[model samples]
Target: MIKIPSKRKRGVIISGQGWQRLQQAKRKMEMQGNAGESYTLEELSKITRLSSNTITKVQRRKFPVDKQTLESFFKSFNLTLIDSDYAEAIDAPPPVNRERIVLGGQIPLDSLLYVERPPVESLCYEAIVQPGALIRIKAPKQMGKTSLMARVLQQAREQNIRTVTLSFQLADTQVFLKLDRFLRWLCAIASSQLGLPKRISESWDNIFGSNYNATYYFENYLLREMDSDLVLALDEVDEVFHYPEITADFLGLLRAWHEKSRYGDGGSVLWQKLRIIIVHSTEVCVSLPVNQSPFNVGLSVELPEFTLEQVQDLSERHGLKWKVDEVERLMALVSGNPYLTQLALYHLSNEEITLDELLKTAIAEDGIYGSHLQQQLWRLRRYPELLADLQRVVLSPSPLEVEPIQALKLQSLGVVRVQNQRVSPRCELYARYFKLALAIT
Candidate 1:
């Protein structure tokens, strides 16, 4: 007797056979009714519970279908294969077309002109070593606070002063809750910047060692490890206020450091060797005593937006060929905002559109910048009463009757400018944002 090999049990497979059988059954069923016409891709997908692309692929027989997929297709169309004659004609779908582009991350500062305040490099060079003095930088959002500080740090490095710049923006509520952890993190950053060994240990009893006092630990550590005088620039210092205890503790420490430098046992040794600079987005509102406050301790430097001349210089630097009048017109539209001015210049540089065309396209319905304009409008619309107040002031041309808080918020948002008792829109950009806000709301 010839020994016949037993058929081996194979693992489960998901084939396109069931799909082919289902398609044939559906065609036959339809032919019996009124199936003289071929089924569209949409119709096939609806019947097979697969995407149009997938059905098209199966029709091309581009690849073998798995058993599970075939089962699904059959179940979706309610069909069963009775024989092997139903599985050979399938195809794959066409490929999708996609475009990929890399974007530049850094804004070219050379192409940017400074109109309001001097360039950061100039300010940094002008910085005199008044060891006991503090420099406070305040600005609205995106007004170049970080850029200026970076320039200052660069200048400090050039001047051979040891500089340690730290930003507290990433400190969340949890990190701020534990003062020790916060101090250690700050110290570690300072250590890294100052080229000192990281001596922070979990087993350490005090955050500051014996040689360094709690208030002047940072200064002490730097002076002990490094020979040069230190320039400590702290960014986003206002964030410390998010935790009241942390804010109080940090401010108190600053006060102690300030005192030790001025009147400590070393007779101006610590104070004369240290320069502290605190940069914030806005004036922090903490409920600390007046003497112990940051407001009392530093020289306030306000960062203002660019002027028309600066914007023109920036345009030229960016290789944008614009007449003086054209530059002025663009400034009128964007209100001398450095970022917006550069953005508008960028858009304009890519095309030969006229100023009027640019503005119309930027503000028109379904235009490129229209959505951004709409978003700005929606932010103001969220406060209807404020919008109403602004409109009333604009229409009737009178002084604002709203509270100081409301007015300040509007000013901060770059919407309104207040001079003496008169309040008006800052520029055409603000007027546009406000008008859109009113129209949409």
Candidate 2:
């Protein structure tokens, strides 16, 4: 079968030498088939009557090579994973570039180190194609929220739906000064992205409020003209929470548009032509009228931390030949935080540090997380209450009861986890590092 890049690409090496040999054998079977013609992994799996995913794992050589797998390869392709071939496979090394760990910033489509999260990715996909659908994804920093949004937008393009992405973080300080100006700016950008001219301002009337003007522009001009549904994705929507006035009006407007789609009245046509995807952090503390709040509606999704299975898969992608215990030990420290786990594994896979060394110095001044921990320290100083709350959490050996709002604020910082009414450091690393940093006894 053909060799597909292992999906478990994080700080990983081939966890087992025997597994790597199986992968080579699978590749060879495809390459040497039908008088030197090759077959795709899927095609080979079909010929052998094996599950495609099983064939893919074999081709990737992701797990330990065993008698059954080797025998299956022989039956499928009349090939062997033994003798000289086996000897050569055992000696072959993993790709050198696999050690590069992605820590922060947007994870490129090619570099995303996640297993396809189900129901979440799939639900977002379903929402994008539906008429007038809005999807909200909430998660703290480094939790892969934006990465998933990128994928959803990609799916929209594949479906021939038009897409426009706007980031609130990139908006000008002056834009948030007034709702009209902000709405107009939004319209201008959307129009520009849609290859339309700046005609939104030409229709602005003094008699109409900016909110109405913005609605008129989208309904009478932009959305009205588009052949396919236009997907408007707003990332970091919570940035406006600090500007309560703008957030209340702007988000309320979004809620109005969303509600209109369900009206089934004559006005439904324009609203149905537009779909919105909003990304925000649940740590947002804003006061808005419950009746007008958009947060209450739409397909809301919260990203959960990676499970152990996913962490293991990502470790393998990094080319690390980690055993189950090694993976569990790492998780015990990082607790499957995607960025943190990948960081630890990267150091291990590339020989920058050993796993024991990583744990020993994970949050020290000269360690992998020195910069990260320092930033958190600086941020907490600005919010003494949060710093105090976290100090109490780290001081305790077990989860501590914290106010719901306080727990959310802590979780947003990526240092705490909350279940029910209790909160604790997100992982052992956070617990150990912060205990000293905060001087919590």
Candidate 3:
């Protein structure tokens, strides 16, 4: 039986073999009269203006050659590397068990709903030398906004795009009062992700040095330090809208950077070389006008709930043996809600329960759907009149304008859908939960 060497030992052996192969290739080219046509390493370095050390590293398989170096090398041979076999070999394998319950840092998988966006990796090559465009993903809670952002960052890395993802979810509530700390944290995160050699504190100090205004520092230093176009995704941006003054100031800086990149001299703006993607749950209100805000500067992408077909696909992916009829029945119950659909599927997958049993258990006293129902009830406690108004709207065949706020809130929660002055529960599951919550409350 052949036994493989340990990873470190194998790496050394493989690298040596690869280096020998490269030398052999060079020899074959020379025998084929290509020696006079192709430049030597030193000669190629002089022509491409790259150091000999860089060429030596590539030949030794110490590190992958930069795109420019590889391009120059190919150009020397009157060939292109765009469709080379070596380029395909550089791609890493996808992660095993890519599907998981929890995604990103804290979002539960059952709650996530994947939406198709412009593939993030493709943008890297297209925007390599140009100012990267902004991406705005707008969605409601439990729609998988954070998970999608995580996937985008992963895709960016696979495409050799330098990427950084910062979530405002963990930002201190005191961010409004302590702008400097907020700025420092943002810089530290960017620095860490970029593998910058400088310490976070040093980088921060260098950018903000004795200057209280962080806006200038971010535009001038932090953005400038990004050697290549970076894909920076900021999640939970709507959370900042609670602090209007800070939100306006920060977003204004982003707008300024974008504008400068468009109209100013080449080196005047850092955003000319940085790609920014901002994601947020829709807010009830905003400090800046929706159209005029910097948040609106990018392509505004909305993530919707899965269609019936998608829900079935998700169930199949989870290893659930769901029939078309079963899938339709479940969709009728959950109204294609990505989260609740998966939650039900998970329980069904774990336990040998019939559809009727699952439905009954969910609505029974102190059951799974019961708690969710009660929580919505608790939210309504502060406004009993609103709750009563909603109950009336639900019971009434026709919708009334008197309960617009209650109706809007219910619709936002994915509990009810309004159509042609008629009010209807989105699905049987939601209806059961709402009824249970009202009953116990």
Candidate 4:
């Protein structure tokens, strides 16, 4: 009788070290020979004389490819393929709920599922070490803004620097009623995070304005108390944007601190010890001079959606051996939205749903994305103007040009995409879901 091999032994995947070596070689080649631009899948396919699917499989290490395919990929990059670089593919283990909580919110620091967006992580890590650096991370909801912020804070901690993270979402409505109350709350929160006493109230002066008092508190107390540099990460800054009364003043105050770090006539040394990380979900709609706006200054990081390759990488990390076509089919509906992709993979990894079943019920109320889509619908219902504008975009046969402010707001909400002042539904799922949700008869 002839012996047959098991399914797990039928193919091979590149090891972690192998993937790193291969990526480094590819990046070096891109820099030296390709004008530093990353080669697209098509460009890579042409160079390797392999199908794009095979290249993706070799690079992503999700689905296994033939040994000859790996050898070809290695040869194209001028590297030799070795046995240690590849391993026999193993069947994925069953999912554990404790480790695979992909419902929503920031991914944990040590989670294998957190896929880096390349230069973005490197940029944030580098920016935080500079004196008085202000790094702004902007993206729509669930685009991993907070997750990135958490990593940045971790990076700061690794450098032996002090770090504090405060989200405006945690602030009470009464806190925004007055600028003084808000500033005091900020200082108090930072103090607590830093293990300092709430001394702001003791030093508070009604005679001086809120901005002045807040600056004085930070410069004199917070900075003086810190042994190393301080990283003040402010998340959900868009909450502050809702209140025009304190938005300009608070942002201007941050700008002032940034400017003081570089151009302070006398206090530059004291202010230099401070670094600010601002994370927001929307564009700054309020008007302010260029010099006074912190949004334009500093290392601005705008988080983008995942690409097809990144989605594949994430799927592999989830222990799902998804093929290129399956990934494309999923992306066709969600278009690489990070949260949606992760949620889909989470369920699939748990063996709860099939891809066919998922696609069919995607827009239904009881689907995996049901609550998420309902949240978006509720948000739109709150703003009639935005609701009407979105309805027009979804109902139209093509992209529509709405009011510029409306376009900005809608794009920020992640409901639509705006390019060259024209707006369209963000994905086919959004279009189909919202068309029914909004009752666009």
Candidate 5:
């Protein structure tokens, strides 16, 4: 927020709780290294989407009494005012629509819905700069895999590593038509991100070929050009798994690079300075050749859904004072699925609906989860074979044995769970909801 200085406005005093909450937010951000005069303040404001003036006032203890604005500012900084006796500076009612529930979406970095699961967060951090480290982040979608990857990248940035995030989802269909085009595209993008000149033309030899040329550019040119280690993060890597011809070679290249880091066999100078992070939903069909797949070799981190305690923390942040029973009831329905639990709570916090109503109508066309469920429904319709498999899985009284590939696909969608080769709905809500939705199939 660009500021134009004005005459000092009289500061409004507030209750101790109100002032304390503001102080906490200021202190936390300060601890996160946002205590500078201009730059830190701007970074903080950018993350929180709150005006720098609002943050300054809150710190001065004369924060404006706008409850929603104050709440937003606090939430952005991951602060929740204890709802006991806090009073606003003005005592004026906020507009009815002041706060909008973020029911469905990617939880932004500012409003990062992260519950630190020890070991996983620390492991990913450690692996990123460990020299040719291949950190594999595997989890179903909407299960905070991307969220965790974002944090990993942030950690790398703090370590002064050159970071580049490439999403295979961004690759056009034509790029995947051939192996050469795709590999060239990959190396070119990584080179551009590192601010290195593309040396493909000079490095390419008809004898050595495109893949080797890409390697030549990376190993011979780009890696030598780097002053610090480079962290190349690839998200949505599952997209490439569908192309077996490309998947084998590309994954092998990564594994080979990782090996080079440990022993500089032929030429490993720059290879050791490159760390790779590959994030994917482990729902792919084909298993790469034993020597080719990089999954088993690297540091693998699987993101589990939020636990009950994690939900409690998130609920408190939402300003919803609920008992343990309430959280459990919500959990029984969502079964710790991060997105669904969030959907139910966002409405509950706003008093738009009760927990019971959310669960009861969650799968309904007009319910909060309607659009999200419909998206899944559409995908299922594409693969009738998969739909038939789900139909059986959902209707069965107990977990049913299913094709391994189908099970992997369903589990990846967060629609079912596979235990001992038996498949069942992941949550009570899914069982009840999909049971009705897939009845006709």
Candidate 6:
């Protein structure tokens, strides 16, 4: 017997027990029908007649969905919706709770902490609808690039577009050893993500070469089979920068694809169905011809640091009644860095420490940022040239110039900001911490 809540709201959240029950049912169905493999979002959408974004919302449970949505979701598995399965969504607490807030990685889709950068999100949303759109989002690590990219994909999904995200971070070292192996890995993973069988062995050809074969697989198999336009997001693309051997080739392929869509390559319409979003932290380190580079062509977005007003807005979201002065004080040390600002507010909201104490210990080993500082220190130590250049910038009273590549790499690390070929420490905290850690006089 199931009971419905007397008062129904437009949105509901799944309870833990209900989620577990649904997962079990889904898995059982997968075993019976999908060869023991989990269904992809597209398949699930077809079964439930819900948009993939809606299905994702149900699974993440971070946002609310209509009660009727859950009923349809449950009905697909032949299960009845019960009162225990969900609770009406009420006004939830601000995302200041340490457990609820995602401190690292992409912010959850339902989070209140994500502040829109206005025209940036709007521009991306508009560009993604155009055929063969290439969106390049370049930002230092932890700068909310991934979060923004997620939002773009969410919008596409809501419009019944297919979205696939592939992170280079997931690739193993050996995958980069040969172009063929890397292409095969890429194709196979994409196939699995789309709930398609691994047909790489049959589709790949030694005679045609890896690049062509990879392109063929996508053109004839993946895109042709898809019912909706595909938004393929490749994240952490900087990982490929270290591998110069395949850098030119792989990036050139993307360029060619973009061109194909624009010019009707071979008069095939399939190429137009793909929209690509590439997220990298730094400029390309390897040399690529301007004509062969995807970076040169497309919608480029460079994420700027939060403005003072944005910082104040974020602080308020974290439940801090910070005035302009308090916000400015924090910015003096962090300079509107998004992750740093959010973490600071999270701590302040807990009343764990005063703003004064936080500022004083910010660069200290026992402070909230001690581990983060150490990690940056470790990365610097690995590259003697970067470490040496950063020491110069930190110790000098004025900004210094370093090798262009070194400046880009350091900026990517979020330790320095480069302007007009001059490099300076990103903030007071970075200067103080690295000056001490690097034994600079």
lDDT (CA) for every model shown? 0.60, 0.75, 0.57, 0.86, 0.73, 0.84
Which runs of model 4 end up more than 4 angstroms from their true locations? 1-98, 264-266
Candidate 3 wrong stretches, greater than 4 Å: 1-100, 103-130, 178-181, 195-212, 287-292, 365-393, 396-426
Query: RMSD per prediction, one decimal?
Result: 25.4, 11.3, 13.6, 7.3, 10.5, 12.4
Tens digit per residue, CA lDDT, model 5, 1-441: 955555443324445444444444555555577442223445656867876556445433434435566567667767774564244344333345534444554455435234555447656765675778899889887787777788778767756788888999999988987878887888889888877777666777879766677777778777787788888889999889878778777888888777777785646666888888988886556667777678878898888777787688678757788889988988987888988877777778878988888877877899988888888778778777789899888889989999998899888877888889999998887787778888855
Please provide TM-scores, in order, for all candidate models, with all chains considered together: 0.63, 0.77, 0.64, 0.81, 0.76, 0.80
Poorest lDDT segment (10 consecutive residues) of candidate 6: 91-100
- Comparing candidate 2 with candidate 6, which one achieves the higher lDDT? 6
Better of 4 and 5 by TM-score: 4
Candidate 4 C-alpha lDDT tens digits along 364-413:
88998999998998887777889888888999999989999899899889
lDDT of 2 by residue, 199-230 (tens): 97587996989888888888888888888888
Per-residue error at 299 for model 4, in Å? 0.9
Alpha carbon lDDT at 320, candidate 6:
84
Model 6 CA deviation exceeding 4 Å by range: 1-7, 10-99, 265-268
Error of 6 at 165 (Å): 0.9
Q: Any residue pairs clashing in model 6, and if so which?
A: none
Order candidates by lDDT, high to low: 4, 6, 2, 5, 1, 3
Itemize residue pairs with steric clashes in candidate 2.
8-317, 9-317, 12-318, 12-319, 12-320, 13-319, 13-320, 14-319, 14-321, 15-321
> Model 2 off-target regions past 4 Å?
1-101
Predicted candidate 6 versus true structure: per-residue lDDT over 170-196, tens digit per residue: 999988878889889889888888888
